[model samples]
Target: MELALIRHGQTDWNLDERVQGRTDIPLNETGREQARTAAELIRADGADWDLILSSPLQRARETAEIIAEATAVPFGGVVDGLIEQNFGEGEGMVVAEFYDRWPNRDFPGGEHDDELGARGVRTLDEIVGAHPSGTRVLAVSHGSLIRGTIARLMRTPYKQVPRLDNTSISLFAHDEDWRVVTIGGVSVAEAIPTTV
Candidate 1:
């Protein structure tokens, strides 16, 4: 199985550096353009995608729609357990301020790290098992969820996994063992720091 994990495009919350966990924020205009560019890149690569799945969030769904339209890949139904981690009262808080205030934990009622890891792993493993052998899939998800999923798959700390940019593709290849071909659509050997 060859899985392409894409982060959803930018939103107003992203531009404002707000914590958008579980907030149904829509994509900004620039986000649509970014999605189009990402779709073009995938098309140029000649990826023969068998499925295109996305988080149910409006932003991720829209981005997936754009990719599906651009690549002519049939968009798959929304997969459960791929939503962003809930931040509770921190949803609209500025990221920096939220971190400063919490220092150690998320907002009250927010999800825990263990829960993040379990959900990410269970959902992805289910995806891998449910799809046919040698399936080539594209899954559009949130930044934190993608990061948590990657960390769980690699058996590393979530913070150790490099952050992915908006519309960036992370390839997960499953052979006898599952491994990552790329972290953000580029060889993991070459690193870049980017934000949505």
Candidate 2:
């Protein structure tokens, strides 16, 4: 299966730099526009996704819905394990504040990196197991989860993880082994690139 993992569009919380973990915040106007632009790029690229999976969070759901409309594919089921890493007491706090509270990046009463990484890897692995090979799938998820999952799948250390942009598409193919086709590929309003 070829999986396209996308981070949700921008939310008010995102603009405000607040930690949004399972907060269900809706996307801002700019975010909606971003999704639409991404959708157009996907269409232009001729990326025909057979499945459109998403996290239950409103941000991810809305972005996935837009992509489904643009790609002309049915929106697939929401997977629980795809949800963002819990921020716990860090929710609504500034990004800097989170670091200040927990220098090691763990939110109080929230999930740790190892567990989050495992969840991300497990969720995609389950999907891959349930589906046949060569299935084109798009999954709308969060930044941290996407990064963690990709890192886990690649077996890379924390320092090697790359930051993902909103609506940025990362492609990975799982035949016998997982191969990263691209990472942090953006969708522009102009002509879409043929390759990811």
Candidate 3:
């Protein structure tokens, strides 16, 4: 199975640098355009996806819908496990201030890193298991979730994972095990080691 994980497009919150967490923010005009650009990139990449899936959040769902429409790919319903991490009290705070207030990156009552990582991996397994071998799937999700999932798959610390840009894609392939193919359009060999 091959999977392409995409981060949702920009939102007002994203531009304001607010901690979106579980907040359901809609995409801005630029965000919609970004989705279109992402679709074009995927089309140019020449890898057809069997279906597109996304988190239930508005930003991710809308991005998926736009991509599906642009690419004529099937739209699979949202996966609950693909939802963004619950930032608890950090939601809506500016990222810089949030870090100043919580230097350890722990928000009061926020979803823990381990929990998010486990959920991300489980979601990946479920998606892969439900699809036939060689099927290509695209999933639209949040930055933290994407990064955490990749970090866990590579057996690296979450902090070591690079931040993903809006609408960026990370590709993975699974045979006996999952392996990183590319990240943010960069080949795995150029971005990071294929295996830790």
State the weakest 10-residue window (summed lDDT) of model 1.
Answer: 187-196
Question: Which candidate gets the maximum TM-score versus the true structure?
Answer: 3
Error of 3 at 106 (Å): 1.9
Better of 1 and 3 by TM-score: 3
Candidate order by decreasing TM-score:
3, 1, 2
Q: Which stretches of model 1 miss by more than 4 angstroms?
A: 191-196
Worst 10 residues of 3 by lDDT: 187-196
What's the lDDT for candidate 3? 0.89
Location of the lowest summed lDDT over 10 successive residues in candidate 2: 187-196
Off by over 4 Å in 2: 186-196
- TM-score comparison, 1 vs 2, better candidate: 1
Per-residue CA lDDT of candidate 2, range 1-196, in tens? 8998889999999898888988889999989999999899888988668889999999999999998887788898799989999978888899888878887786678887788889988888888987777788999999989777766776665435666778998877787777666667733212123222
Error of 2 at 185 (Å): 1.6
Clash number for candidate 3: 0
Q: Estimate each model's TM-score.
A: 0.91, 0.89, 0.94
lDDT of 3 at 93: 97
List all candidate RMSDs to the true structure. Answer: 3.3, 4.9, 1.6
